[model samples]
Target chain A: MSELVPNKSIYEFYRLVEEHHILLAFQGMMTTDILTMMGKNLKEQAEDHIFHRRIFSVMVELVQNINLHSADKAYSESDKKMVGKGIIVLSTSADGKIFTVASGNLIRKSEIESLRQKIDHINRLSEEQLRDYYLEQLRAPEDQDSSGLIGVARRAKNPLAYDFIHVDEEHAFFLLTVPIHQQNSDK
Target chain B: MENFSIKGSNYIPTVHFDAKSGVLEISGESYHEYTVEFFQPIIQWLREYLATPGREIVFNFKMVYFNTSTSRRFLEIFDMLEDYQRSKKGKVTINWYYQNNDFDMLESGQDFAEDVNLPFNFYTF
Candidate 1:
């Protein structure tokens, strides 16, 4: 058996996360129940009502992407469902002026190109254009494969940052980061 | 038609549609595991209601949050209402209620308002 030893690298990573004021970080099977519990906890922890709702909405959408689309899955006996395996980190900027939700999961390499194109298209649209796109999609035929990426774009109202890192010939790790500005105290 | 009402759960919103009064209200949060399954009945009810064509139909939305799938169903409801209005079946009004200072909710209502021809009355509680 290999001896378990504390690594200095882990200490450095912990320091980095602490310095960023990360609110929540989890790496495991993500189920709807867990998402709901996390959302409830976040709602209680967040002081600003509007920002709290924004954070909750963004978190739900991001986690759902993993739950529905991630190629990596874990069976949960409690929920009697296949849960997505992924890592998610919710953090505030060092200045506490903005919040960022980041999630990573394995995805089929074949799906990357279309996903990338969709994100790129959303990034190019103006707010007005985005609203139009949202409505158009809302009226479109229901596709279970659809991840409602437009809702994420609409809530964040910022260009989504993403990367696909090659894992194998058939799969890759998809990482997505969404940034939301904290509402001004006066507003 | 009999009145329809469903209590809200952690993942489903409360629905109250008074057949006698012609007022339909949905409130609380909705992120159901099976979005279609949760909304199918309500959609069917609304369809039947529109067939009768009341004098005035008022739909109220007081949602705290809803997933994108639920939003799509909501759009369907709006389309049905729009059809009813266009056919001169009734005077349709949408009342969207939100907490004060919740701009996200307010803006969401505005977004829906823009998509439909009917005006949405915004109320803050």
Candidate 2:
């Protein structure tokens, strides 16, 4: 390997993240310990108690989903083990009125259609319908589907935004974005 | 039966099941990576304890935050309690406590109450 200096690349990435108004960002292996630490840091950064809790709840669901569903894997140096790899970004609107918790992870191509349908279905439900649907899903058998995303939509009280960036015939990068309005935050 | 107690951490809830007193409680946060595995022994213990007939069980859930998977385990526990109560085997009451001003927590308790047949009482702390 040739010796290389990448200070410019580092600064460029920093500028890019800063330009996005990102409050917190992580890209690498996802694990329970890392999630706990990230949650604590995010909570401490927020001034409003309720706001922090709501955002924390959304973040937990998104991060854990990555841990459970992401098809990409990477070696975590600190953990000394391979774990799911993903990216999570917490950003706020320019007006500081809304916060968005977004995550990106690679997933198998076959899973994209079902995921799309699930998000579309969740987006269409009224709050009451969502609650009823959530409770209904809770009573269903333990299948790795539906409940978590429904919880995210219910807690957000807003439509979930998502995209599937096709990478190859067998895989795609899945991105999920959940928005939390500061005004509607009673929890 | 031996009393079952597991101390909590930042990611796991503290579970204390007093077989003698028949007051079972799970408090604190539960976002364990292996949530199903974590609750297995606790559920198994409840199963064995309920095998003995005519016992009154009071279940308290005071959770600060729990992941969706924990919610499923909670339902499993509730189903078990419902079964125990329905068969004339035992008397069961569930007390769900949520932090003051945390309506989400309160609603979570309510949703669980709606799903099962057991009697439920909600309290704000």
- The TM-score of the first chain in every model comes to 0.87, 0.90
Residue-by-residue lDDT tens digits, candidate 2, B17-106: 999999999999988766778899999999999998889999999988888878888988998898988885799999999888777788
Which has the greatest TM-score?
2
Superposed by TM-score, candidate 1 places the C-alpha of residue A20 at a distance from the truth, in angstroms, of 3.8
lDDT of each: 0.84, 0.87
Per-residue lDDT of candidate 2, residues A32-63 (tens digit): 88889887997778787656787888888898
For residue B86, model 2's alpha carbon misses the true position, in angstroms, by: 0.4
Candidate 1 residue lDDT tens string, B27-93: 9998764577789999998888889754588899999888887888888899889988888567889
**Model 2: residues >4 Å from true position, as ranges?**
A1-5, A74-82, A141-143
RMSD of each: 2.7, 2.1
Error of 2 at A16 (Å): 2.2
Candidate 1 lDDT over A28-88, as tens digits, reads 8877777778888887887887777777787887787887788999898766778788988
Q: Largest lDDT belongs to which candidate?
A: 2
Which parts of model 1 have CA positions greater than 4 angstroms off? A1-16, A75-81, A144-147, A184-187
Q: Candidate 1 docking: what grade?
A: medium
Residue pairs clashing, model 2: none
